[model samples]
Target: MGLEVVPNTREVLIDLYTKTLKEIQVVPEDEGYKKAVESFTSHRPKLIEKKLGCGQVEELIEEAQDELTLIGKMIVIEEKKWLVDEDED
Candidate 1:
C-alpha cells in the first residue's frame, strides 16, 4: 500500500526535529546517545530542504517521531536517577 500524504509533512517534521533537539540537551554531551542524536537530527532537516521523495520523507518523519519518544524516555530516566541520588543523600 502507498503512503498517505500528510498535508503538512514538512511542518510536522520541523516541529518534531526541533523539539527532539531541544529535549536532548538534558543528555550529557559526551554520551554517545547525545552525539548520535545530534548528528541525525541535524541531518534530517537538510533532507527535507532538498525535497527528497515522498517515501524517503515519510521514513524520516517516522524516524523523528521515534527519536522524540526515545528522548522522552531518556528524560524520565534521568529524572528518576536524580531522585534516587537525592534519596541516598
Candidate 2:
C-alpha cells in the first residue's frame, strides 16, 4: 500500500523532530535512553534537510511522525515514574 503524501512534509517533519528533541529533555541526561534519543533526534533535521534538497522524503516523514508519537508516550511514562518516586519519598 502507498502512503498518503503530506502537503508540507518538510515543515511537518522539522516541527516534529524539534518537538521531540525538546520533549526528550525530561529524561535524565545520564541515561542511555536519553542519549540514544538525543543522538538521533538531533541529527534527523539535518538529514531531512539534506534529503529534501535532493529528492523525496515521504518515508522519512512517516518515520519522524512515528518517533514523535513514541517520544510523547515516553515522556508521559517518565513523568508518571517521577510522580511515583516523589510520592514514595
Candidate 3:
C-alpha cells in the first residue's frame, strides 16, 4: 500500500514486514497469518494520507517494524484458533 516502511541503520522495519508475510503467508482461508496481515494492512490507508519529504522514510520504517514484529510474534504462537475464539464472542 503506502510507505510505512523506511528502515534505518538500527531498524529492520521493511525486512520484518517481508519476513512476516513470508512466515505467515497471507491468505483468505487461514485466519492465522490473516490476522497479522490485517494489522500490517490496516496502516496502509493512514500512511497513504501522509506526504513525506524523503525524510520520513526512517520513521516509516520504524513504524512498520513495530507492526511487522507483532505479526511475527503471532506466527510464532501458532494458535490462530485462539485469536478466532475472541472474534466468535
Candidate 4:
C-alpha cells in the first residue's frame, strides 16, 4: 500500500486562519460591523469543512481565500473611514 497524505482538520485550519486574522488591528465600533466580522470568521470554517467533506478541496480553498480578501478590504475601508472621521475632529 502506498502512503496517503492527510489534510489538516477543520479545527486546525480555523485556528490557523484565526491567528492570521488576529494580526489585523481594526476594532469594530458598530454592532453591524461586529456581527458581520463574527459571522464571517465563524461561518467560513464550517463551510470549508462541508466542502472538504464533499471532496471539493480546491473550491473550498479558493472560496476561503476570496472571503478573507473581502474581509480584509472591509477592515481597510472601516479603518480609513475612522481615520478620516478622526481627522475632521
Which one is best on TM-score? Answer: 1
Query: What's the candidate order when arranged by decreasing lDDT?
Result: 1, 2, 4, 3
Candidate with better TM-score, 1 vs 2: 1
**TM-scores for all predictions:** 0.80, 0.73, 0.38, 0.50
Candidate 2 Cα outliers beyond 4 Å, as residue runs:
52-56, 87-89
Shift of residue 3 alpha carbon in model 2, Å: 0.8
Q: Could you give candidate 1's per-residue lDDT for residues 1-89 as a string of tens digits?
A: 75666779889999999999998998988889999999988887887888675456667778788999988998899899999999999
lDDT of 3 by residue, 11-79 (tens): 354455556556556444456557756665444434445654434556556566665676667555656
For model 3, what is the error of residue 86's alpha carbon versus the real structure, in angstroms, after optimal superposition?
18
> What value of lDDT does candidate 3 attain over all alpha carbons?
0.55
Which residues of candidate 1, in runs, are more than 4 Å off? Answer: 1-3, 51-55
TM-score of 2: 0.73
Off by over 4 Å in 4: 1-16, 19-37, 40-55
lDDT of 2 by residue, 1-89 (tens): 88888888868878877887887787788889878878877877787656555336777777767877887898798889989999999
Q: For candidate 4, lDDT tens digit of each residue in 1-89?
A: 43233376465557645843563335454656556656666666777745545445444444455656766787788788989999999
Positional deviation of 40 in candidate 4, in angstroms?
A: 5.6
Error of 3 at 78 (Å): 4.0
How many clashing pairs does model 3 include?
1
Clashing pairs for model 3 are 6-61
Worst 10 residues of 4 by lDDT: 1-10
lDDT of each candidate versus the true structure: 0.86, 0.78, 0.55, 0.59
